[model samples]
Target chain A: MLKENKKELESDVIQLVPQLTLDCVIFGFHDSSLKVLLLKWKGTEFYSLAGGTVRQSESLDKAAERVLMERTGLDKIFLRQFHTFGNVERYDREKIKKMLAHLIDPDLWYERAISVGYYALVDYMKVFPNPDALSDACEWWDLNEVPALLFDHEEILEKALHALRLELSFQPIGLNLLPEKFTMPDMMRMYEAILNKKIDPRNFQKKILKSGIVIKLNEVKRGVAHKSPFLYKFDPEKYEEVLREGGLFFI
Target chain B: MLKENKKELESDVIQLVPQLTLDCVIFGFHDSSLKVLLLKWKGTEFYSLAGGTVRQSESLDKAAERVLMERTGLDKIFLRQFHTFGNVERYDREKIKKMLAHLIDPDLWYERAISVGYYALVDYMKVFPNPDALSDACEWWDLNEVPALLFDHEEILEKALHALRLELSFQPIGLNLLPEKFTMPDMMRMYEAILNKKIDPRNFQKKILKSGIVIKLNEVKRGVAHKSPFLYKFDPEKYEEVLREGGLFFI
Candidate 1:
């Protein structure tokens, strides 16, 4: 696998854009916690976001989708281009050499590159992680527990989380991160996890209910001590309309 | 001037990242209308937004700011990156050749490129437009009267405007487009121009007042015939705080 990847990299360098790349901060929600998928570099302890270079034949967005699919095996998820990181200091030559090491030729690497950062929201249980050619393992790490990342990935991940939280104010993002049917507390918990702060449960419930994008189901979520909260699911039409018209105010 | 510009371009090409560029949609509100700053290409009837390439030495944002300053002569204005356009069809070889006709070398031109789109808001009266080397003139155009632009610049402008409208819901953008002291009617008019829709004056006033980012002054404008409206100005500290904390909801 290593030899094939090195050969492919040597030849494909001409086909790929030398100074442009895309990185994904894939976030998942499970076990009442917010998590991010990270890749463990081959023969190194450093972890980084799943990312790859753009091919000359593909669009930037297509490249991002390809990266997400290659690492998570999940297609058609809610992937958003949040921000592009192009600080000159982000490209440390020594760091790049250490990260790529034996996988790529030293001469093929460019000294400076710009990364377009994207963030994806996926269901935790559905994703089966797959490492790319240069990585040995792919897995989920709780947001706080994530190890030191390669390059400026730590900054990229922070900005992605910030973008997600800001998006919650005016978009129905819960639909992408939460299950099809969830209790009000469950929804609140997901919001709490993303925001990384405590939200007033009553305030959150009131806002979500007033938005009219979610529908209250007759069935209840069982097995919570003595209380069984009513389960609710998104009204797909209303959710679509709200997303189109842009005024959900879900925070 | 043309020879000097050509020489500069020839020398600067190697300094810029060949496949990446930045474009700006500079929006200004005046005369009860929204205006965009556009450049008329040298010796051609085409217009395009103020834009430039990312230098290897500078970051993406620095490149955008440089482009904005070179054209508008205004520094430290509200510049926000809205989107990055990288569609395969955005690059039309014949179209680009026509646009750059006599300016650039055919061999140096790239077949495919990506553009980072940015939008800026500035006081209409403050900007003194200056054309770049490839452009003959830079001037303001009413949003409705924008001419057929070069490349996919029309799409880029539309996306920037959409992003600006979306940002209005969460940020206090009036501070950038309006004067230090303005009336409620003036504020409402600017909003209407950007949103391209009439908002009920009462509802708009109510929301703005409740946001607590603007302060009412004791003096009223005396120029009006019958009834004079009180003036208001932004509470700068509060506005900055709201921007930092991220929950202004200004519609």
Candidate 2:
């Protein structure tokens, strides 16, 4: 069955658009740190974001969505195309040939291919990482511990993070990375993780309340040894309204 | 010479990457209105942004730079890749076939092509718009007066403009769309044009002055019937430092 699948993969390559691909940087938050989804290549030290090719009949966005679903077992999340990497130097023909020798024809069309970079924000607790055919393991890695990636993926990852950070500066996008019910401290920690720095606790709370995207709920969080903190869920209508009226950020 | 060049173009198409292209929305500001550069197809009322195909040896950024230089006769400006458009519905086979029937073979490889969108901020006075081989004229059109564009270009243009506006909401990008020396009123008008609304004059002055991206000059305007406004220029070092520090916007 493996042999037959490999043979079918060679024939299926013809249906993909030549010289165009998509790579997704899936970001999730957990344990007070921003994490990124990565896949470990089978029997190799290399890791990379889940990527796929665009089919002749599908849109680029759909291809990215399909790739995200195949790897994380999650869909309908916040995904955005941040940038496209197409430097001639990014195509290391000999290295790629060696890396995929067991999987692909190797003579396959990988010369100067362009990859559109997309960044996705998913709930940490909901994701179930699944490896692709060429990878042995797929899981979340803290941003600080991310190893050197394959191809131009490291640069792509940096750019994706930078774009996400820039958006966070003016927009309340941290809500996407947190659970529906979270504390103000949870929100501030999410922002600090993405920004890679510390923000004033007093300032964050004051400004966030003034922004009015979050509301104070009547219930407190359960299962806490210390004094339980108040639980808060995003006011969806207020959040959407603030987004439309030129977003206000606390950080 | 024209016939020979046409013959060369037919074979040269093979050098271009199949199913990938680029379109640039070159924006300029003049006379209190925001303008976009467009090309009118030869002997037809159809209009489109200056665009080109990527070559096998070049990066996407390099391809966009080449296309921008070809049309605007200007280089070293602020150019950015904003988004990539790849909808299956965007490809109108019959329309493109009829439009380029005189230029290329009927069986060209344009089925479901993906176009990377770029937006350029250029000085209005520096541009020398030149028509491409298939275009009769290239000129600037006011954003309000832009005609129905060819292909999915209208949607692409709108997206580029929206991206620029979103950036403006968080960053002081208006400097790129203005001249080297300008007055406070001139800067305010530039902002109003791009935002497509009026900003309170006193509030704009107070916020922009506090932002410190611009330096007030001692000299006043030379030609004016009423009181002449003082001229000012951007402080490059301060502007760049603010950008590096995640930008401070007045709008």
Candidate 3:
């Protein structure tokens, strides 16, 4: 019954002008550091986040996946829609009018585009990202070292970071950043990196241990400390359940 | 600087299909009731919530306001965008493709239309609704009495209700539903209506009092069989601050 309606909607979308695009805020943790994926635009000093337009035949989710694959070379990862950016001034139409007064045709200069923001958490080591035709370089920037970004991209990145922090408050995240089995210090470092704060070591361990989401492994760290920290692995099943129940683990 | 980009985006949208619709889930509280504004389509048995298409040169938010005003004769009420219903199946094209196969051209039937969902909170008694050209009647249905709605409207309403409930948990809402000054019972009834459950009277009162977002009016209800409940009014400044801080108050 719903299939027929879907077909009609697909046909309708094909007939309309393609004004929608998907902008991704891809976050990755590496070397106990928080980073975001960005593309340095070719021929310009500006860098932008990895993003692309939605195809007529694709769902918004599919479009986001396509963008992720094309930009990051990652086939599948954890990606979710966070919000849509649609303020009238978001596109900054007034400035465009003056800049393109003579260089570009006026008719082609002003095009209204609304973008859906998608945030993805991925294993940084697994993906090999390549810049598209319009970009010079595609790379990960430490959250603290972000350069000037184009088209409200900075604002978009900030929103994604805020959402990620909130998600961390409840979910057992940053697992993507670690190996299958990791030490407590490794996990704590990831938290400290993303939070950009020095947490009390004793208190942090106590809070996380009480949450019961993490399971301690008999294996210990291999090197570099007076006493090796115990290895831990996140229980995905329990982590998901807690997320579904809207539970939060305070730091 | 951003204005030029916005102009380009706007022009791009115009090149797309012409139909841009605004659908609203207008919620009202009456007689300890929680209700939603809905409409009956003119030629079909399918009932729907109040909605309409946007005119050329009109902003999406303005389109929502216009649709709200045209249907309910209410202005300056609190309205917010919850989600954009742009799934390819939004229009039920396959049914239309089969049902109007002979009468309507397939090209016309597939014309893309994007509808934005906005939920509004208004005083039920203040509205004087008149159905639009596509609808037979405009009416309010108790939240519990919602029938099968047309298109993806049921899903839209569910999402809106979820957002509303989340909003209620953090903010002292439903001020628009009450008179200038209302008794504690009136406030409690509204809370129960939105929460959709019987709450312990003592606990509910205690929780609300502790939040300190509401002010006691000193006046009391006059025409009740039991002792008159003290009147209360929401402190707008405090309520705003609570909402800003993401404060939670559970009943």
DockQ for every model, please: 0.65, 0.78, 0.19
Task: State the TM-score of the second chain for every model.
Answer: 0.93, 0.91, 0.83
True contacts kept of each: 0.51, 0.79, 0.07
Model 1: residues with Cα > 4 Å off, grouped in runs:
A1-7, A10-14, A95-107, B1-14, B99-107, B206-212, B215-218
Ranking by lDDT: 1, 2, 3
DockQ of 2: 0.78
Candidate 3 residue spans exceeding 4 A from truth: A1-17, A31-33, A94-110, A165-179, A182-213, A222-227, A249-251, B1-20, B54-56, B96-107, B198-203, B249-251
Ranking of models by DockQ: 2, 1, 3
The TM-scores of chain A alone, one per candidate, are 0.93, 0.91, 0.84
For residues B85-172, what per-residue lDDT tens digits would candidate 1 score against the true structure?
8776685777677557677655666768888999999999989899997889999999999998888899999999889988887888
1 or 3, which is superior by DockQ? Answer: 1
lDDT of 2 by residue, B184-236 (tens): 99999988998898999999888778878899999999898879999989988
lDDT tens readout by residue for model 1, A1-251: 24556576667654877688899999999988999999998888879999888888898889999998888888998989988888887947876775575776666666688899999999998899999978899999999899989888999999999888877778887777889999999998998899888989998888889888899999999889868999999998998888877786755
Error of 1 at B52 (Å): 1.0
What is the CAPRI rating of model 1's predicted complex? medium
lDDT tens readout by residue for model 3, B2-93: 22334654566533324446679999999899999888766566688888655445566777888889988988878877666656667677
Error of 2 at A5 (Å): 6.4
